[model samples]
Target chain A: MIRIENVSFKHRATPILSDISLDIPKGGVVALIGPNGAGKSTLLSLVARLQPLQAGVISVDGLPVDTTPSRDLAKVLAILRQDTTIASRLRVRELVGFGRFPHGRGRLTQEDDAIVDAAVAQFDLTDLSDRFIETLSGGQRQRALVAMAFAQDTDYLLLDEPLNNLDMYYARALMRSLRSVADANGKTVVIVLHDINQASAHADRIVAMKSGRIIADGTPGEILTPDMLDTVFGFRMRVETIEGKPFALHQL
Target chain B: MISAVSKPSLWTGLIAGLGLAVLFVLSLAVGVSPLPLNKVLSDPEAMQLLAVSRLPRTFAAVLCGAGLAIAGLIMQTLSRNRFVEPATAGTAQSAELGILLVTLLFPAAALWVKTLVAGGAALVGTSVFLATAHRLPPQQPFLVPLFGIVYGGVIGAVATFAAWQADLLQFLSVWTNGEFSGVLRGRYELLWIAALMVAVAWIVADRLTIMALGREASIGLGIDYARMMQIGLVIVSVITALAVVIVGMIPFVGLAVPNIVSRLMGDNVRGTLGWVAAGGAGLVLACDIAGRLLRYPYEIPVGTVMGVVGGAVFLWLLFRRGGHG
Candidate 1:
């Protein structure tokens, strides 16, 4: 379980996350939904220990984020942020193999190689494996980055806006991959998503934030109402039931 | 990811290594006074010449090249800019500043003493460069190195002023223009530390490669980003200081070799480190050999040749289509 308590973060006097508390139990998909600058990404970063906890307590699997050794914490949780700017010229297989560094201390064992191959296959990146990262299209590159995080084999995966460069087709494909990974491996996937419908379709729970505070938290069916969407996004949107799932018509 | 045609395969490494070995023998032969190959078995003078000057100069050139290139690789990774290196980042100038300060205090200080102080100074200066580069927008990759060149120039200007005041201008000239004429066996042994630093880089090549993924990805991979950064700083500083101290400034080996090697072999340091080391050594040897033969019996400083050649390469890197950012 990832537990966050009264976590308040300020970036040079501008409150980014203010007194936010949330409990994310293991083994399910939880989507954090909000407008831009609503602290969804910041909260995910805190839970994954990407940033130092400034105000309160955060623990993953009962180990406090601030105190736990990063290596130990990494074994349990892995995070993939939106800014995935790679500096070096690296091949896709090599990039995915790096995800095994935490486990093997830079040397990939046979087991680690198998895991990497599995991740490469899982993301359907077999053909692109030998190509350099810079040569891939933006969506393919994002998929490669996701494949790397998946290869990490951490129980809790915190992805902040992983769907950024992906097109609609690949975006749905990625969502399905994450959903299957969570279900098959019993991994806790905490994703910050901008698409409400993607969240509605794949997410087991939707936590909505507005102004650094949680405005709504429940199953997608309970939180996708027009009134709840307005409270979180600060605008009203029409909602319709499609295949027993709430679909918000926010774009039209 | 690019599917580069040149992978660092065994044949690639063997060919590069063989080429460097040939260059090494060639360097030993093309000097002002040739040690007769036939007389070397019976001639003590030839042996003395070989032991005293030829071997030391050759080793120093190779070590200097390999070390600076490795340092440049680390610096580029740390700054996340392909163009940044010790010479441009104020590291070499800072080492000069430290050596000047030490010379003023203790004119007879040991070379090691000067080296330690210079390395420390270089560390501080490079840290400042790293911090400043971080604040600047990384999207504009050229800006970081432009800032570094300006910053290094300021430091270099100050060092020049100090040398002028102390009437140490001649000393400055010798150190600033690198050549092997002054290298006797005992004088050039300090560059071996740079050889050692290269080994250290090899041992930690994987970690350094991970750093190229940026701080967030590196940390997520269980690396302590700050510690790896510190390691990078130390490697660059020590190598820059020692190279500057031992044979003076041999520019561009660090900058050019890493860039070219990565283009050929990709940037997985485990695979590229050997090629980088070989490429660096080969470049300096080739430049040094050219310096010796350009006007036979009257040598040009290797530093001058490198500056001219490296400057041209730098411009090409900037202007070429499909060039790196």
Candidate 2:
């Protein structure tokens, strides 16, 4: 479980996350949906301790993020941030193998090797594993990055906009993989997503954020209503339930 | 072969080691006198000549080259900019300052004592440069190197003032222009400590490799990023100071060799560290030999040779189409 209490972040004078508090339970995909500048990515970054927390407390799996040894925390949780520029010379296989670093410190044991190979196969990157990351298209690179995070084999995975740069086909494949992993592996996946339908179709819970605060939190059916969508995105959208899943027709 | 891209292949080591061995032999054999290798084993005088000047000079060149290359690669990793190096970041200049002060205050000091003081100065200077460089907006990656050049100039200015005031401009040149002509059995042995620093680098090679992926990723991978950074700066500064003390300052071996090795072996430090060291040794040995041959008995300083060659290669690295700067 991940816990946050009175978490408020300020970048200089402006508040990025204002007095936000939330608890994420174990073993399911929880999709955070919001418009631009809604503090979704900031919240994820804070939980991962990418930056120092200004005024709050955050804990992952009962370990306080601020004081826990990074090595210990890394074994339990993995995060993949968006817009990271990697060194071009690293191959996809090498980047994915880096996920095993926290365990072996770069000397891969046979078990770690098998895990890396499994991650590559799971992400459909078996053919491209030897290729340098720079040669991959944007979508393929995104998949490799996500694969690296999965290779970490942590109980909790935090993905910040993992769907960015991915086309619809790869995007759906990635979501389905996340869904299966959440179900079979019992992994806790907290993902920040833009496409409400992707969240609706795949996520067990939907979290809506607006102006640096969580405005609504419930199952996808409860959070995907037209009224709640308007409050979060500041616009009304038609909601359609298909096969027990509620998806918003926001593009129209 | 493609698998070699992500990790160090055995071939890379074999090829680089072979080239270094050949260069080492050439370095030992090529000199003013005819101390033939096969004859030196039997003749006492030839062995003396080989042991006294030839062996030390060759080892110094190799150690200096390997050490500076490792230093340069670490600097680039810590700063995340390929153009930045010890020479650009005031490390060499700070060591120069340390040398000038020690010379002024204690003219009779041992070379090792000078190295210790100079290493301290270099550590401080490099730490300041890195701390400031880290705070600057990283989006404009070029700013760090530009800032380093200016920072180095500022430290160089201080050394120049002290040298001029003491009327020791000639003495200063001894620290600024690197050569092995003055190197003897005892004089250049401090560079062996650089070998130790390189060993330490090998021990932490994986940590350094992860560090190149940026701070967040390094932390995520459970590396103590801040501690590794301090260790990296210490390694770079000490090797640089040792080289400055023994052979003066050689430029661009660090900057050029690591970048070239990265192109071949990719950025995995464990895979590339040996190649970078061997490539450094080979490059410096080649230039030193060229310097010996260029002017005949007069013998150009190795630093002078490096200035011309390193500058040309640096220009090529900068303006080359495709590939990183």
Candidate 3:
């Protein structure tokens, strides 16, 4: 479980995240949805300790994020941030192999190599494993980056805008893979998503944020209402149910 | 579907090794007072020149070449910008400043003392550049190198002004124009220290490779990014300072060599470092040899020759990359 209390973050003098508290229980998929500048990525960064906690406390599975050694924290949690640019020309396999660095400190044993292989296979990257990352299309690169995070083998995974450049088919494939992995391995996934219908179809719970604070948190069916969408996004959207799942039609 | 890029082949290593060997022989054989191969063993004067002058010059050239290349590789990786090197990033100019200051204040200081002071100044200079770079927004990739060039220019101006004020302008010119003409046995020993540092860099090549993955990814992989960066900065400063002190400023050997090696072998430091080192050493040796033969006895400085050749290569690299960065 991840816990946050009275968390607030400010960049320079402007507040990015206001005082907020939330608890994420273990072993399920939670989709974080929000409008632009709503602090969704900031919140994820704080939980992952990508950013320092300025005015609050965050703990991952009872270990305080600020005090815990990064190596120990890495074994328990992994995060894939948005807009990561790699300067080196790394092949897909080599990039995925870096996920085991926290465990092996660069020297990979047979077991570590097997884990990397599994991650490549899991992401359907076997064919593209030897291609340089610079040559990959946007969606292929996204898959490779996510595969790297998956190879970390952590209990808690936080993905910030992982679907940025992904097409619909790849996005659905990624969400389905995330769901299966969470279900089969008992891993906890916290994902920041933009498409509300995708979150409605795949996520076990939906977390809605507006103006640096969580406005609503519940199952997708509970939080996908037109009123909740209007409050969170500052606009009205139609909500409809199809085959027991609530989908938000915000395009119109 | 696995489209593996071509790895560095054994043939490449063999060829580079053979080339270095031939260049070493040429360096030894092509000086003003050339010693015949047979006479080198029999004549005391020939043997003395080989031991005291020729051998030291050859070794210094190789070590300086390899050291600066590795230093540049580390700088590029740490800065996450290919164009950032000792010459552009103000490290070499800061070292020149240290040499000038020590030359004035402690006129009797030994060579090692000057090298150490220069290295310390380089560390400070590089640290300032890094601090400023981190504060700037990362919008344009070329901005970092442009800032480095401007920063280096400021430091170079200060060094030049100080040299002029102290009446050491001649000394400054000699030190800034890199050459192998003065590498006597005792004078070139500091380059061995640079060789040692390059070995140390090789041992930590994996850490450096991880660093090239960018800050967030490095930290996410549980690397203490700041600590690794500090180590890289220290290595880069020390190598650049020592190279500048011993051979003057060998421009673009650092920049051109590593960039060329990465183009051929990819950027995994562990796999590519040896090639980069070899390429650097080979390039410097080739330039030094050309300098010796260009004017026969008078000789152009290796720095001048490298500037011409390396500048052309750098321009080609810029255009090859479509000038985006």
Candidate 4:
């Protein structure tokens, strides 16, 4: 379980996340949905210890995030930010192999190589594994980045806006892959998603936020109503039931 | 999925090694007083010239070239910009300033003492540049080299002004323009330390490669990002200081060699570090030989030749497709 208690953050005296506390259990997909500047990414960054904690205590499976060594934390949780740029001329497979650095400290063992191969295959990147990262399309590069994160083999994966720059086909494919990874591997996934329908279709739980505070938290069926959408997004959006799952039609 | 381990071809290594060997022989053979191979072996005075002047000068050229190129590679990786080098990043200028201060304060100081002081000043200057570079947005890659050039110009101007005021402009000129003419037995030993530092770089090549992935990803990979950056800065400073102190500032060796090596061999440091080092050494040796032959007994500085050659290559790099921002 990942427990966040009394978490608050500010950027140059302007509050970003205020008095936020939440509990995320292990082995389920949890999607964080919010409007622009709703502090969704900030919250995820804090949880991943990408940003230092100002007023909070966070623990992953009883290991305090603030005090835990980064190497130790890396073994339990992995994070993928939206704008992570790599400057090195790395091929897709080589990039994914870097995820095993914590385990091998730069020397990849046979087992580590197997894990990297599996990650590449799992992400449908086998054909593009030999290509340089700069040569790949945005969606393909995003997949490579995600594959790198997946090769970390951590218990909890935190992804912020992973769908950015992805086309519709890739977006759905990525969501389905995440869903399968969470279900089959028993890994806890906390994702910040901009598309409500993607979250509603694939996520086991939905948490809505507005202006740095959680407004609603429940299953998709309980939280995807038109009234909740307006409260969270500050606009009315119709919610429709599609094949027993709640889908938000916010495009109109 | 393909395996991640990519090694440089044996042929590339063989060719670089052979080229370096040929240049090394040429460096020893050509000079103001050309000593024939049989005469040097038989005549004590000829042997002395070869040992005291030619050998030391050759070693200095090779070591300085390799060290500066490796240092440039580290700086480029850490800064995430292709153009930032020891000369442009203010490190060499700062070391020159340190040399000037020591020369004025302790005119009788040993060569090692002066070199150490220069290294210290170079470290400070490089650290300041790294801190500033980190705070700036990395979206525009050109901004980094521009900042470096402006920053180095400021430092160089200050040094020049100080030298002029102290009536030491002539003394400063020797340290500003790189030449192997002054390299003798005891004068060029400081660059051996730079060679050792290059070995250190090879040992930590993987860490340096990971650092190029940017801060967050590096941290996520369980690397101590700040510590690695500090290590890189120290290596660059030491290498730059030694080069400046021993042979003056050789432009473009560090910047151009690594860029060319990476373009040809890829960016895997483990695979490319040796090639970069060899390429740097060969380029400098070639330039040093050219400088000697250009005027026969009265030679131009290697720094001038490199500036011309390296400047041309740098411009070509800028115009290359997908080369810059």
Candidate 5:
């Protein structure tokens, strides 16, 4: 389990996250849903140690996130933030190869190369593997980035709005891929998602936030009600059960 | 598998052999006296010019070019921007200021002492740029080098103003313009230090590449980001300062050469590192030869010729590459 205790963060003078505390269990997809400026991405960044901890403590599988060496932490958790753009003309496979750097130190062994190839195949990017990243479409590039993280072979995967810029088909495909990976491999996949229906469909649990505070936390069945949606998003959304899962219809 | 991405073997061999041949011919045949091949073989005075004078000048050009290009590559990688280089990072300007201080304080300081002082000041200047960049938002990746230019410009203005008041503007101008003429028996030996810095860069090229991927990426990969950055900055400063001390300021050779090579090849730091060195040496050698042939007796400074040509070519390359910023 990943446990965050009394975490608070401020950007200069403006408070971004306030006294947030939560425990995320392993082996499932947990979607963090919130309105704009609700600190969803900031919280993910903190858990990944992309940003330094301002107050309180976080532990991943009993190892303190701050005190642990970065390489060890990298083996345990991998994060892909939104809008990741690097000014390099690198092929998709070469970019994926970097995920093995913590282990191989840029001199890839047979096992590291196999892992990279697996990630490429798993992401259905075999054709695009040799292509430059800048030449790929938005959805393809997003998949390539996720594949890079997958090649990291971490237990915990944090994605901030992985669905951004993806079309409806690609978006659902990505969510389904995350769902199966979490179910089959027993990995902890935490994602910040803007699509409420996607969260309702793929997420095992939903954590809703408002004004930097966790307002609701429970299974999707318990948290996807119109009342909770109104509380978290300041709107009344239609909720219906289909195929033994709650689906929130917020479009319109 | 022999992929299309790989450079052709023949092309590589041809470029390497031709580059070496041109550099050797330039070192032997062209200079103040233009010693014929026979005279260089038989005459002692001509032989001294070939060994001590023309030869060192040639070596200095190659070493300076290679060192500065590697330094530029490191700076560009660390900043994660295409346009950044030691030349653009206030490093050369700060080194000039250090040299000025050394000359003013001790009118007869040793050449090595002057180089040390210049390199120290450059290290401080590069550190200041990096530290100040850390405080700003990460969105403006290009701003780091842009700010460096502005910062270097301010310091350069101050140096010019001071030199004007001291009535030593002529001497200071000659020092700052980056000449290969004074590179004779006793003075040009300082540039060998730059070759050592390039060797050090090759040894740590992997860490530098990791650091270039950004602090989070490097840290995530279990690399010490700050430590790697410190090493890169030091390497850049030393190379820039040493090159300046030996041959004044060579303008954008650092920025232009590595950029051109990386465009043809990929961003594999190890692969690009050697090509950058070779490309740098070739470019500087060609410019120095052109400078000698153009004015004959009057003789243009290689640094000034490189400034004009590199500036035009660099702008063309920038526009061709769709303008980085």
Candidate 6:
């Protein structure tokens, strides 16, 4: 379980995240949905300890995020951000291998190798394991990045907008893979998504934010109501239910 | 057929092997006074020069090159910028300032005293940059190095003013020129400290690599990003300061060598670091040899040649980059 309490963050005088509080229970996919400048990324960053908390407390599985040893935390949680601009020209296998760094440092054990290989296979990157990351397409690179995170074998995975730059086919494939990974592997996945339909179709819970605060949080059926959508998004949107899932028609 | 199918480790070993052989030959054969191969073996004068002057100097060059490259790697990792290096991070300038102050304050201070002062100053300078980076808004990582360069320029102006007042302006110029000609027996031993720094770099190379993938990724993995950065930057400053004191400022050996090696070997610091070191040593040796050969008796400083080569390559990279690869 991840708990955030009374978290308020500011850059200079401008408050980015104000008086935010939430508890994310263990397991399943939790989709964080918000438009641009909605503090979605900032919240994800705080949970990952990317930026220090200004006036709040966050804990992951009872361990304080700031106080815990990083090596211990690395074993439990891993994050993948949007701007993955690594300077090294590492191959897929090599990049994925780094997920085991907190465990083995540099010298890989047999278990480490097995884990990396399994992640490569899981991401359907087995054929491209030897290929350098720079040579891969956007979708392929996204898969490789996810594979790297998976190879860490963490229980909780926080991905910030993993769908960026991905084509429609790859994007759907990635969401499906995440859904399966959560179900089959029992890993808790928190993903920030721009596409609300994808979140509505796939997520177990949808967390909506606007202007750096959580406006709505519930199951897709509950949160996708027109009134809730209007409050969170500041506009009315038609909601359609198909096969027990609510889809918001906000584009038109 | 067996030889044609080369293993990855073998390829790495082969590159390292070739680098060592070339470095050895270059160290022995090229210098101000040429000794015949036969005479080099038997003559005491030739052997003494080879042992004391040439061999140590070559070793110093290799050590300094490798040390500076590793330092640059750590800086680039800590800063998370491709263009940033140890020299660009105000470390080299801080060391230069330390040297100037030591010389001006106490004219008869020991070499080690000056080196210690320089190393400490470099560490402080690097720490200041890290502290500022923590406080500042997250921008392009390269901007940290640019800001560092600006900070270094300001500090450099102070050093220049002091040097001019002390009538040691010529001495100050030598820091940027980076000559190894005076690196004989007693003076060059200080570079052994840089070799020790290489060992330190190896121990923490994994941490530095983890830190390079942005502070958030590292912190998410349960690593104290700031502490790791501080450690890496300190190591970078110490090695750079030691290198500066021993042979002045060898520009861009840090940036160019590591960048080239990572291109071929990939960017895993643990995997490519050996190649980075070997390639750095080979490049410095090759440049020094060219410097020796270009002018025959009156050699151009290796630092000047490195500056020219590094500047050209950097410009080429800037102009030719079509996309982030």
Write down the C-alpha DockQ for each prediction: 0.73, 0.52, 0.59, 0.47, 0.37, 0.42
Clashes of each: 4, 0, 0, 0, 2, 2
**TM-score per candidate:** 0.98, 0.96, 0.96, 0.96, 0.92, 0.90
CAPRI class assigned to model 4: acceptable
Q: Per-residue lDDT tens digits of candidate 6, residues B153-212?
A: 888888889888889989998875777787888887878887787787788776667676
Per-residue lDDT of A1-252 in model 2, one digit per residue for the tens? 999999999889988899988999999999999989999999998999888888999999899998998999889999999887786478888899999988887789999999999999988899998788877888888899899999999999999999999999989999999999999999999999999999999999999888899899999999999999999899899999999999899888
Q: Write the per-residue lDDT of candidate 1 for residues B71-184, one digit (tens) a residue.
A: 999999898888988987899999988888898889899999999999999999999999999999977888898999999999989999999999988877766677777899
Residues B1-325, candidate 3, lDDT per residue (tens digit)? 2346677678977887999899999889888987787788899999999999999998988998899889889989988888878988899999999989999999999989999999999999999988887766766667888899999999999999999998999988877889898999898887888888888888888788889987888878787888998999999999988888888989898899999887776788888898889888989999999999989887889899999999998888888777443
What's model 1's interface RMSD, roughly to a tenth of an angstrom? Answer: 1.9
State which candidate has the highest TM-score.
Answer: 1
Worst 10-residue lDDT window for candidate 6 chain B reads B1-10
lDDT of 6 by residue, A1-252 (tens): 999999999999999999999999888999998778999989988888777789999998998887777778888889998877655567788889888877776778999999999889977889888777877877888888888898888888999999988888878888998898899988889999988889988899999999989988999888899998888778999999999899888987
Comparing 1 and 2 on TM-score, the stronger one: 1
Candidate 2 deviant stretches above 4 angstroms? B1-12, B137-139, B321-325
**How does residue A148 of candidate 5 score in lDDT?**
88
Q: Taking chain A by itself, what TM-score does each prediction score?
A: 0.98, 0.98, 0.98, 0.97, 0.97, 0.95
Worst 10 residues of 3 chain A by lDDT: A83-92
Estimate, for each residue in A1-252, the C-alpha lDDT of model 1 and write its tens digit: 999899999999899988988899889899999999999888988887788888999999999988988889889998999878875789999999998889988889999999999999988899988888888888889999999999999999999999999998889988998999899989999999999999999999999998898989999999999899988888999999999999999987
Could you give the fnat of all candidates in order? 0.84, 0.56, 0.73, 0.55, 0.45, 0.64
Calculate candidate 6's fnat.
Answer: 0.64
- Give the chain B TM-score for each candidate: 0.97, 0.95, 0.96, 0.95, 0.92, 0.92
CA shift at B195, candidate 4, in angstroms? 1.5
Instruction: For model 1 chain A, give the 10-residue run with minimal summed lDDT.
Output: A82-91
DockQ of 2: 0.52
- Show where candidate 6 strays beyond 4 Å: B1-12, B32-34, B37-42, B86-89, B128-151, B322-325
Give the TM-score (vs. native) of candidate 3: 0.96
CAPRI quality band, candidate 1: medium
